[model samples]
Target: MPHKNLKQTGFDEMNLSPDVFAVLQTVGYEIPTPIQTLTIPRMIECKDLLGQARTGTGKTAAFALPLLSRINLENKRPQVLVVTPTRELAIQVAQSFNDYGAKMKGLNVLAVYGGQSYSVQLNQLKRGAHVIVGTPGRLMDHMRRKTLCLADLTGLVLDEADEMLQMGFIDDVEWILSQIPQPTQIALFSATMPAPIQKIAGKYLKNPEKVIIRQESDVTNTIHQKFLMVKNINKSDALVRILEASFHDGVIVFTRTRNDTMTLTKILEEKGFKTEALNGEIAQAARERTVNRLKNGSIDILVATDVAARGLDVDRISHVINYDMPSKIDPYIHRIGRTGRAGRTGEAILFVQPKEKWMLKQIEKATLRKIEEIALPSNREINEKRMDDFKNKIYQTIGTEDLCVFTDLVESTAKEQDISISQVAAALAKMLQGNTPFLPETMAHKSAAKKKGTKAEIKAKSPVAPKQKQTPARLTPNKIAPTEKGMERYRIEVGHKHGLKPGDVVGAISNESGLESKFIGAINIDYDYSLVDLPFGMPKNIFNLLKMTWVKSQKMSISKYAC
Candidate 1:
């Protein structure tokens, strides 16, 4: 009934099984996280525990290690059942059990969730799993079908209990707990103790040991937080500019739902980025593969919903972008926690709209950090960055790669063409660039007022001459439609004739592709369809995908606009 000390402790001091301790060492876990340090020992002692900790505090291992240690591996009849709110968390918990119990000779762990096939789960259940990690709904189904029996169940853990409550699974959770024997050791972990969660705990838990670990806002101190004010329609366009401007090895873009994840992933891929989507709709096996791909550097960007990205740990992730902000503070914390891990400095960028400034203030208060407001990087800035990168690439190649063959060819070409060596080098550079533009035509213009207090303050302070306003020139036959410099114009089938508005087109493309609206250019509605300006170099696959995307009950039929 008493609380535990919040002192730092080592896993070795917790009196865990040697196999479990050895696996922990192998997994690079040295000292226990705060929650783990406080809760693991009590759990090992078979005490009913009620733990309070935020996500990303290593709560999974705190309960998992103790349960695995207590499991009678030989008698395998689902001795430990971990019920999570979402399929992602269930898979994550099962993976943790497998990892912590790796050296345990006959230990079997299986994750059961709604999206997966019942037959697959039944086969694993019949084969006899020592531990089962599952969502409440699927677990209830199996229990009703008599596919999952709890005759030998010894331990039950309800992870993210508040999340389950918010998801309206508290009744199902209480029912599940009722079915388990009273003697079954229960451990409930939640970020916050709402009335409902507490009521459930009071009824179900018997003299539960309490371990409260508050997540400090300073946990995100290592992350450089920045925000950009963008209109809802321009978010995807803004996102593209940010991605092009920033130097990141790996990035995770968090969305609000599964559909957002898919749409954004398609948009990024069309823009020629190596991206993937993670959501509840994806099968468990495919989810595993996608995460693995992210870790191994096959995919540089991942668009995901909060539920799908729960418990995702990939060390290589350098940036976390909140494309669609979370409604709650806890999820915001969890989303940003994906980066700035393993003692590395990371970046967290949030795209805010005029209406969402209140949420921004809430985040600042919750995190106790001042998120600097930043302007969207102009085309000139992106081009400068590209040039710097190109120069560095050549210098790096000169140091690391053998350029003897290429250098000789360049010299021979220069001599044969009677051109200077510098001209020959420039020619080679242009050839290497192919059709890619070396410089962006125009930058996204920033208002003078927004430039205050930023790095552009000096420029804002400087006086400038005013020019007369003039009508914009029309597009010539040889020219692409005039747009904000750096953006190219394309055509989609849905237009005024199809009862499409600019917002409708923006919403469709932004939601479907994850492109920010700011990056999207002018829309000239035509009789049959519309012509919209989009970023150039869209991948063929993405273009095809957009063609099939619907807008106001009509296929987009998107194509490049040729002058």
Candidate 2:
């Protein structure tokens, strides 16, 4: 049985900031899809969100938009932090923040990973990024440098969190989360929720709000989808232009979920366009009839959910618009494949925000095709396209024989109203609109109004002072002196207040400081610094390397324990 899939519908009702809302409208986003509807409010209220949604259900925006809303542009340190499994995902998540936040002034996002240079990571942290999106390992590196501090953190998001745990990054994540203030709001989004992950959530998150988007809402491979990379803000304005330029017989806007679908549908309808809703909650019989109507040309656009729109055997689906970008690489392949089938090159259009550039890159990576980033169609361009389309509709309507009576009526009305035939055509345009205007008011370009750049340029933050290389002296029992080898005793800055046992000190220093696990002869955690034994009488070079390493939360400089 198909679950009642919800479509993303409207924004006027939500509590999102105007700057964020303006970005959404330009990108053609409607109401909150199910995840957005449920998650957006909670995200704004600073509550922990435990969301259960599949790959393509609009989960990214649900979190990104709200999380970004909390970021203080003036606050220097990382206020919003997201931990993902891999470098690619970390990079993608960072892009999402930039896309939704294109209108938010002074918002900078950086992606951190192991392969990236440490000096580079230090630079970005120092450059005053408002949000930090990174893999656990690199983020841990920042914590050690004290370049990226969490004391002022407002939100901590763990995206695709289960995958991080499965990949042996849970320990790193837990350690990082612990360093953050206990009052931080945490949001965890994963496709499959495992017990271990839930346990971690239970242990860390404050009373969380949980919501799951059904699977059918995800893009189906049987259908085709394609997205465009545009160099501007206000993807929604671009979408309107594209719709006018292209010939789509019937369109179902696949948003992240119900709220998005409804929101988009209402906005389109308000634009005096003929649009209707189709989703999982609608009966199957109604769903089939809707598709049939589209096939027979009774309806030109049916905004529906992926679940409800499935099994739609309509070959006339000339276009599939991805109003919201897909998160994973696979769905993109599936959505674009919906068109250009049966020997026809069907069109697929995606409205990408400034942040969605990475998502576009991933789609290209998956499909092995380079999607061109086109310029936003101007209002003049859209008007011309609409005129061309209207002319085509007229030619097609004239080719059919069923308009005899309507034509006579138009002729008589023209004569009675004492208007020229051209004026009558204009009058019909006004009449068809009736109470609703056919040509919706042209929305202004939003990304242009934004103070932030249309594209986010990746830049290095600041250099963390590399841990000073210690000159190893001779071994002094209680004191740390530079010797031939590294320091005989590893120096620690934390003590009992850190709740660390001797084994904890031993394990952390050994693992991070890179000294042999067995060679850590003695660990004495006193009032301030701890002394850990190591191989002595080596070289000064290795000792210098050890100085750059870090233990649990402290950097192990090769020095004597300071009382």
Residue-level lDDT tens digits of model 2 in 304-344: 55444432335566777877776765444444544543335
Cα error of candidate 2 at position 248, Å:
18
User: TM-score of predicted model 2?
Assistant: 0.42
lDDT of each: 0.82, 0.67
Task: Return the top candidate by TM-score.
Answer: 1
Per-residue lDDT over 1-563 for candidate 1, one digit per residue giving the tens place of the 0 to 100 score: 22244567789899898899999888899977777888889998999999887666678889999888877767978899999998877877888798889999999999998757678888889999999999999999999899999989889999989888877899999999989975899999987889999998999999999988654523486689998888755787788889988889899999888777777776787676898888765545557778888999999999888878876878799999999877988788878988886457899999888889999999999888899999999887888888888898989999999889988998899899999999988887889877756666633223433545566776688787798899965332223347767777788876555567789888877755668999788888766768888887776755655776666545688888776
Model 2: per-residue Cα lDDT at residue 239: 65
* Overall local distance difference test of candidate 1: 0.82
Residue 471 of model 1: what lDDT?
A: 92
